[model samples]
Target: MTKKDKYQKVAYYPGCALEGTGHSYNRSTKAVGKALGLDLVEVENWNCCGAMEVKNVDPKLQTYLSSRVMSTAANEMDMDVVMAPCNGCYHNLKKAEYDLKHDPESVEVVSKLSQKAGHKTYEAGQVETIHALDWIKDTVGEEGLKERVKNSLNGIKVANYYGCMYTRPRHIFPEKDQGPGSESTSKPHFMDDLLAAAGAENVEFPLKTACCGGAHTLSDSDTSTKLVLNILKAAKLAGADVIATECPTCHSGLEMHQIRAEKVLGETVDIKILYFTQLLGVALGLKPRKVGVHENVSDSRGFLKERGLA
Candidate 1:
C-alpha cells in the first residue's frame, strides 16, 4: 500500500511524558489528528520506550523496553505502523528496530526479556515507527493542510526547533535524507513545511536541531537553562514570535528555562514556546482550549487569540 494509505490509520504511542508533563502535546496531537480525519488507535497495554534513563543505564534493556511497545502494536493490534509523538519514544523505537536488525546481541536479549515478561517477542521488521511529523507530513501533505486550514496562522512567526534526539546519531533512520521530498537529518524541514502550509511564517532559525540539554536538566540545571536560552534568544533574533516544537521534552525545556533564565540569571528573552501540533490544531479551527494551549507553561492562548488563531 502507498504511504498515504498506510498512515491514515495507525497505532499511537504517547509515551510517559505525554501522560504527565506533556499532556498538552498529547491533547493537541489527538485534536489535530481528528481534525485531519486521521485515526489514532492507542497501543494497548503500552510501556515506556526507555527514554534517557534506561538507555543511559543499559542500551540493551532500553531496546527491550522500546521493543515491547512495538510488539504490542504488531502482534496484538495487527498494526504495521506505530506513530510516536515524543521524539524520545520515536527515537528509542527506531533505535530498537535498527539494533534488532544489525546487532544480534540486542536481538537475543530482547527475545529473552520478551519471553520472561510474558509477551510475544518483537522480531525485526514486525512494525514501523514514525514521529508525529512523519505521520502528518506523509498522510496529509502541505497541500492537504492548506485545504484544511480554517484558521490560518498567517501572522504567526515561528522558529522550528527539532532538538537532538529526533535526528542525532542518524544511522538508525534509513528513511531520511533519501533525496527529494524526504526529511533531512542535518537540516530537517518537515515541521517548517507543515507550519508554512498552515500559513505560519517559518523563520530561518539555525538552531533547529541543537541540543536543549534535556538529558542534563536534573544533573545540570545551569547548563540546561543556558542551552534553552540560546535557542530562545536565537528565535527572537530571527523575528519569531514563537518557537515551534515537536518533542515534549524540548517543548517543556524551553518553557521552563525561559522562566528559569529570567528568575535565576535575570537573562530573559521574550518568546513563546509551543508544540507544532498545537499550532496546527489551532490553524485547523480547533479551539485553543481543545489543543490544550493553556496547558503549556509558556501560555499562548491570549497570544493566539489576539491573532484570531484561537
Candidate 2:
C-alpha cells in the first residue's frame, strides 16, 4: 500500500519521558494524529526501551529491552509498525532490530532473555520502527500539512533541532538517505518540511544534528551546559526566535541550561524552546494549552499570543 495507508494505524510507543517530562510532546502528537484522522494504538503494557543510559551497562541487555517492546507490538498487538516519538527510544528500537538481524550473539541473548522473561523472542523484520517525524512526513506530506492549517505559523522563526541520536552512526537507519522523499542523515529536513508547511519560517540552522549533551546532562553538567549554550546561541545568531526540538532530553537540557547560563554564567540568551509537535498542534487549531504548551519550562505563551498563534 501507500505510505499513508501503511502508517494510518500503527502502534504508538511514547516511552517513559512522554509520560513525565515529555507530556507535551505526547499530547500534541496524539492531537495531531487525531486531527489528521490517523489511528494510534498504543503498545500494550509497554516498558522502557533502554533509553540512552542502560546500554552503557550492557548492550545485549539493552537489545532485549527494546526487542520486548517490538515483540509486544508485533505478536500481541498484531501491528506491523511501531511509532516512537522519543529520539532515544526510536534509536534503541532501531538498534535492537539491526542487532537481532545481523548478530547471532544478540539473537542468542534475546532468545534466552525472552524465555526467562516469559515473552516471545523478537526477531528482526517482525515490525518496522519509525520516529514521529517519519510518521508525519510519510503519512501527511508537506502538501497534506498545508491543507490542514487552521492558524498558520506565519512569521514565526523556527530553528529545527533534530538532535544527535536520530541520525548518528547511520548504518542502523538504512532507510534514510536512499533518495528523494526519504530522510537524510547528514541534512535531515523532515521537521523543517513540516513546520514550513504550517507557515513557519525555518531559519538557517547549522546545529540541527548537534549533541545536546543529554546523555551526560547530570554526570557532566559543565560540559552539557556548554553544549546546550552553544546550540541556543547558534540558533539566536541564525535569527531564530524559537528552537524547535524533537527529543525530550534535548528539550529539557536546552531549557535547563538556558536558565543555568543566565544564572551561573550571566549570559542571557532570549530564545524560546518548544517541541515541533507543540508548534504543529497550534497550527492545526489546537490551543496551546491543549498541546501542554504551559507545561514547558521555557514559557512561549506570550510570544505565541503576540504572533496570533495562542
Candidate 3:
C-alpha cells in the first residue's frame, strides 16, 4: 500500500441517490478516496436532502430534511467539512445552509418543521459543506494523482459534462477556478480537472455544461429525452467514446433513456456514460467492477477492456 501523511477523516454524506440508484458513485468514492490516501468516514444516521424537486414541494420540509443531515454530521461526527458527492445533494444542502443563514424567517420555520419531523435544527455554517471535486483536488494534487495512475486511458476520449447543478446557485465551490480567480464565468469545469488528473483526453463538447433535463425527466420524459439526446449527440459529434458526469441524475437521465435517444437521432451513437468517481478509481488502479462499472446502463467494460486496463 502507498503510504502518505494522514489527514483528518471526512464525514462523507452520500444522499438518497447515492444510497440507492447512485450506489456506484458511493462505492467509487470510497475506493478512489482510499486509493488516493484519504480517509472517508461515513456520517452516522445520515438521511436524504429531499432532492432538488422536493425542495419546491415544501420548503420547510426540505430545509429541515437537509439540516437533519448536517445536524448529524455536526453533533455526531467530528469532521468539519461534510463531503457531499452528489450534485443534487450538494446543491440542496448548500441552499439549505444559505437559507438558514441569510433568511432568519426560513430558519425559524425550518426549526419548527424539524421539531415536527422529530429531527434537530441546525444553524447555517455549522458544518462547512463541500463537493467531492473540491476534496479530490485539494487532498490529492495532480502530481500525486499522476503518480498513482496504474493505466493511462490514452485513446479513450470523454466529453467532460458538468451539467447544470455542478456549477450553479450559491454553493458550487470547486478547488480550482477556470484560470486563477476568474469569476467572470459562474460555470466551471471542476470535473475536467479530475479528468486531466487521470490520463483521458477531455474534448470540449459544445454542450459540455448544458442542462441534461435533470428532474424534468420526472414530469416530462419526452422533453427530457430530447434534451439528453442533444447532449449525447454533441458528445458523439465531438468524437467522444463516453460522456463522463459528476451528477448521478445526469448519468441516469442520459443513459437510462439512451435507447430512445438513439431511436430519435436515427443512428446508434455507441457511447457509454459513467460517473467521475468510477473514472477516478480506474486512474487510481482499482478494477472496473470494484468501481461499479457494471452498474452503468451503457456498458463501458468493452471500452475499458480495449484500453488494456479493465
As for candidate 2, its clashing pairs are none
lDDT of 2 by residue, 23-115 (tens): 888998998899888899999999999977789999999999999999999999899999999999999999999999999999999999999
Give the per-residue lDDT digits (tens) of candidate 1, residues 1-310.
9999999999999999999999999999999999999999999999999998999999999999999999999999999999999999999999999999999999999999999989999999999999999999999999999999999999889999999988978899999999999999999999999999999999999999999999988689999999999899999999999999999999888888888999999998988888999999989998999999888888777788799886
Using all chains and alpha carbons, the TM-scores for the candidates as numbered come to: 0.99, 0.99, 0.90
User: Clashing residue pairs, candidate 3?
Assistant: none
Poorest stretch of ten by lDDT in candidate 3: 1-10
The C-alpha lDDT values of all candidates are: 0.94, 0.94, 0.78
Superposed by TM-score, candidate 2 places the C-alpha of residue 41 at a distance from the truth, in angstroms, of: 0.7
Question: What is candidate 1's local distance difference test score?
Answer: 0.94
Question: What tens digits encode model 3's per-residue C-alpha lDDT throughout 1-310?
Answer: 1112223367788888887778898889888888877888888878778887677788767777888888888876755668898888887888788788778888888888778877667778778777787777766767778888887766778897877766675343433255763321245656777778788888877787688787887688788888887888889989998788888898888886687666765646678898888987887779999999998778888878888768
Worst 10 residues of 1 by lDDT: 296-305
Better of 2 and 3 by lDDT: 2
